[model samples]
Target: MYLLGLGLVLLLMKYLEVDPVATWSWWVVLAPFAAAAAWWAWADATGYTKRRAMEKMELKKKQRIDKQRESLGLKPGKRR
Candidate 1:
């Protein structure tokens, strides 16, 4: 998506016969930093990374429970 935006920007500059280096100096300087910050903000806001971490933790917990049940010679879904 960012690449698409950059391609469009370049195409527009070409079509307009503008010196992109001059016209887009600020963008060149700022776009990458802005993109990185936006990505970080979105990740933080959506808690996607946090959710993944939680999922891993849950899986580990389930594995440990299964191991304990096996050690007890008990089958899952059976009340003892």
Candidate 2:
């Protein structure tokens, strides 16, 4: 995401002919986008993306359960 943002910024700078960026090669301006793609591919291949999604789901589930328990006058469950 950071890389993508950087790519976007560089692209904009290049397009607007911002001083230093305007002087840079197109390949240099586009490098961050390529890097972002590579990072995404690596993360997916390593299950990093799926693991993060599962962890997020588990956290939301726990929060939901805790909210319900609180509404029912039960204490929040202990954390793992």
Candidate 3:
């Protein structure tokens, strides 16, 4: 995400002819986007993406359960 943001900023700077960035090659300005793509590919291949998504779902589920329990005057379950 940081790489993507950097790539966009560099692109804008280059487009606006902002000093050193304007003098840099398009490849240099665009490298962060390529890096971001590589990072995403690597994350997907390593199951990191899936694990994060599953964790998010689990958190949401636990929160929903806790909210229900609270509404019924019950205590929230202990965290693992």
What global local distance difference test value does model 2 have? 0.97
Superposition TM-score, candidate 2 onto the true structure: 0.91
The better candidate by TM-score, 1 or 3, is: 3
Arranged by TM-score, best first? 2, 3, 1
Runs with alpha carbons beyond 4 Å of true place in candidate 3: 78-80
Residue-by-residue lDDT tens digits, candidate 1, 33-79? 56767776887899977998999999999888888998999885466
Clashing pairs in 2: none
Global CA lDDT computed for model 1 = 0.71
In model 1, the Cα lDDT at residue 48 comes to: 78
Worst 10 residues of 2 by lDDT: 71-80
Cα error, candidate 2, residue 63 (Å):
0.5
- Superposed on all Cα atoms, the candidates' RMSDs to the truth, in angstroms, are 7.5, 2.1, 2.1
The per-model lDDT (C-alpha) reads 0.71, 0.97, 0.97
| Backbone clashes in model 1, listed as residue pairs | none
TM-score of each: 0.48, 0.91, 0.89
